[model samples]
Target: MTTSIVIRDEQSADAAQIAAVTLAAFATLEISGHTEHYIVDALRAAGVLTVSLVAEIDGRIVGHIAFSPVRMSDGSAGWYGLGPVSVAPDLQRQGIGTALISEGLARLRAIGASGCCLVGHPAYYGRFGFSNPPELALAGVPPEVFFALSFTGQTPRGEVVFHDAFKATGPTPA
Candidate 1:
């Protein structure tokens, strides 16, 4: 049977659970540096997590997604980066990730965000209207995995720089 999932903005009390879920989700992924939990914490501490959502099933947090401000070399504004999206390993392929992403994108638009971009599997993001535009790119990332979705129909041209919080690979200094 499928469990009911509730999507909502994360609360301060959910921070620890969110970190656990993120760690579990990416633990076995070969490409993951296993630092996603740190990234989320860094984003939160830096005050740049434009959108942070969690999926809860019967009071247990199972999935999470984060969006943060991104800078475009072409001087575009209101663009955000999507990533560190996590779902419980056992819950993979059950629409939890999809729900988090869909809701996150909708929330971004509601807040006047012009666009969102991410480096993810090409096949997964296409369903959400993400495409690798010729004019927009992320340095050091392959074009195929760099996808962008423009809510205002204007795609920016130039390098996309994700928030510096993405560089967090360990605990933040006090």
Candidate 2:
């Protein structure tokens, strides 16, 4: 596990490994409100997925992150929303997830995305600059657990509907 793990764009061939990692990570969550596995499949099938990146150690996949298109309520702007980033449970806290997030955000920014939004623990994501901008709102998302960070441009306040896949796979939080 000491060898440097490489972060690279995911290929169609990596689908199974990706799913396995996702299942492992989501299982650790306190809630199963979201079907992490189905969401990834739907995102891939829907073609909204913008970035699919993976981490590997000695050629075995260990972590992953997916970014997809999202919009504000006003539709005034569009940005990539980060989600469902996962690392094999055994790999947690090894900085594998951190590398995936860092590299994925940089890639999204390089592609001209204005920002990234997500639902996650404020404490963990805050360390990476994920926060809810008072000026931005994704309706139906708890203002507390909901988080966002900008790469550039204004992130407007509005209802945030994560792709339909999110709903189909994970029950929406009331």
Candidate 3:
């Protein structure tokens, strides 16, 4: 059976459901620090979530993806970082995450973004035209897992600094 999946921009009301999906998606992944939801929240709070999208099936958010601007050591502009993409644990192998990523990248390019990068599994991101460029690095992250896709045909050289929100380990203090 083919399920109809709708990919759309996130609305204010989807915040809770998005967080739930993000938490459930990374809960069992050993590589996850279990702070993905917090990172999303922080990104939203900081108003730097350049592109935030949600995947809906039968009116429920089942997956989410976020893209945020990144600062490059070489002063490159229009570069964004893709990360913390999430899909419901039960729906992992489905195409939901892929759909979200495709749409998000399209939106980024439509807005004139020069490039996008992420720290993700090479196996998965490679299919999306992402590659580990020796010219780009993300500090302590291994080169094998850091991927980049240049929309403008020119990859930036130097370090890629993701938003500070990536450091969120918990909810914002009240």
For model 3, the stretches where C-alpha displacement exceeds 4 angstroms are none
Each prediction's TM-score versus the true structure: 0.98, 0.91, 0.98
Rank the candidate models, highest TM-score first: 3, 1, 2
How do the residues 78-174 of candidate 2 rate in per-residue lDDT, one tens digit apiece? 5777888999988899999999999999898888788889987777889888877777767677788888887765766667767776765642233
Sequence-dependent TM-score of model 2: 0.91
After TM-score superposition, the amount by which residue 102's alpha carbon in candidate 3 deviates from its true location, in angstroms, is: 0.3
Which 10 successive residues of model 2 have the least lDDT summed? 165-174
Off by over 4 Å in 2: 170-174
lDDT of 2: 0.82
- lDDT per residue as tens, model 3, 22-52: 9999999999999999999999999999999
**Residue 1's lDDT in candidate 3:** 19
